[model samples]
Target: MTGPAAIRAALPHRYPMLLVDRILTVSADEIRSVKAVTLNEPWYARLGEEPSKADFAYPDFLLLESWTQTAGLLATRSEEEPADGRTMLFGSMRDVEFHRRVFPGDVLEHHVRLQRAVNDTLVFEGSSRIGDEPVLTIGTVTVAFRPREQLDPEHAGRNSAPLTGSQRGEKS
Candidate 1:
């Protein structure tokens, strides 16, 4: 499984921000990544109670971020050019639905399907699941692509080929 370090190498994300745990599958226009739920996650504190049960829950915003990261991985991993100098900004969210509660140890899987891509925009439908049950789903979203030079300074960095979902054992 590709850990955070490998993901960082593939994508320009660092500690406290990188969300994808391991890429699990990838094709030309699709990618799936895994995020093994852990009790030590920073967001767990907001859960009110230390997740004593396997059925612990996660906040919706965090789940959305996780799903968004998966979408980025799909675009970066499958694209012909995955230069670190490029970045994607989430433009809009549509038809998002939260299903079952996601808890620690759930090992949530994100399946991102690229619906369309043209010019510098990409639309994807993403779903997060625990095994066969879906925990979250976003029907659609449009993300804008931009050169790293145009992004905020805090988002610039370099991660080479060691981060491809195919290169890493994480699958996509």
Candidate 2:
């Protein structure tokens, strides 16, 4: 099992946002990880006494975030530690589906696979499950690593220009 220390070394996320708990397995093209959902999570802080079942249901977005973080770790594994002032950014998501309501006490196991890679951009496919039950399925998720300045227009300069179509492996 890969611990939080290794995750911290590869990812820039921190507490309250670092959703992945530990990696189960990793390979050149895929990774498996898990996140345990519990009432103690910050997302439940706003709930009052006698909260409804819906209140205990983990948010779909957080599930996706956790799964994507796993994908990011596998995608950048071969790189020489993440570069400074650079961050991984989601480019696109397609055909994603949430099949079940995940609640507290559920352990989400994510299986992510590297679909394709071209230069600094990567495409991934995966799914999340609670034991034998499927919870989330991702068709494709695209991500790219870019300088922080490129994401902030006010800070963007000649060196921070956005990638062009061809640069992103797209047809003109």
Candidate 3:
């Protein structure tokens, strides 16, 4: 079981944004991770007293983000380049579907598989589950690693045109 310190070292996400809790297992092509959800999360703070059960349900987008973060960790673990001064940019997500609503106290277990990799672009497919029941499934997700300087508007010359997804190392 890998702890938060290792996860933190591999991912750039910080508090309130770092969604993955711990890594259960990781290999060259696959990774299994988990995230424990709780009522104390910031997403639930906005609700009023005695909010409906539906109101307490975790946001779907956040669930996806957590799963993606797990995938990022796998990419970092397998890649040779250091993550320093580089940012992982989400290029695109396709065919994502939610099967069940997740609430506080549910532990989300994610299993992700590396589908393809070329240069700095990575493609992944995965699913999330709570216990034995499936919660979410991702068909394909593409992410790219880019030097931080390339993302800075100030550094990208004022007159220079913005780089397309291909130029940014994203697979079209």
Give the winner by TM-score. 3
lDDT by residue for model 3 over 8-66, one digit each (tens)? 98887998999999999999999999999999999988999779989989999899999
Candidates sorted on lDDT, descending: 3, 2, 1
Off by over 4 Å in 1: 1-3, 46-56, 152-172
Question: All candidates' TM-scores?
Answer: 0.76, 0.84, 0.87
- Residue pairs with backbone overlap in model 3: none
> What would the per-residue lDDT of candidate 1 be over residues 49-143, giving only the tens digit for each residue?
54455435666787888788888877776566665577778899999998888877788899999999887788999789898998888999888
In model 1, what are the clashing residue pairs, if there are any?
23-170, 24-171, 24-172, 25-172
Q: Give the TM-score ranking, best first.
A: 3, 2, 1
Give the 10-residue window scoring lowest on summed lDDT in candidate 2.
78-87
Per-residue lDDT tens digits for candidate 2, residues 1-172, read: 8999999998889989999999999988889999999889999999998898888899999999999999988977844446567778887999999999999999999999989888778899999999999999999999888887765644666666667777667996
Query: How much lDDT does each candidate structure score?
Result: 0.77, 0.88, 0.92
> Regarding lDDT, does 1 or 2 come out ahead?
2
The better candidate by TM-score, 1 or 3, is 3
List CA RMSD, all candidates: 10.8, 5.1, 4.5
Q: In candidate 1, where is summed lDDT lowest over 10 consecutive residues? A: 154-163
lDDT (C-alpha) at residue 138 in model 2 = 98
Backbone clash pairs in model 3 (N, Cα, C under 3 Å; residues 3+ apart or in different chains), count: 0
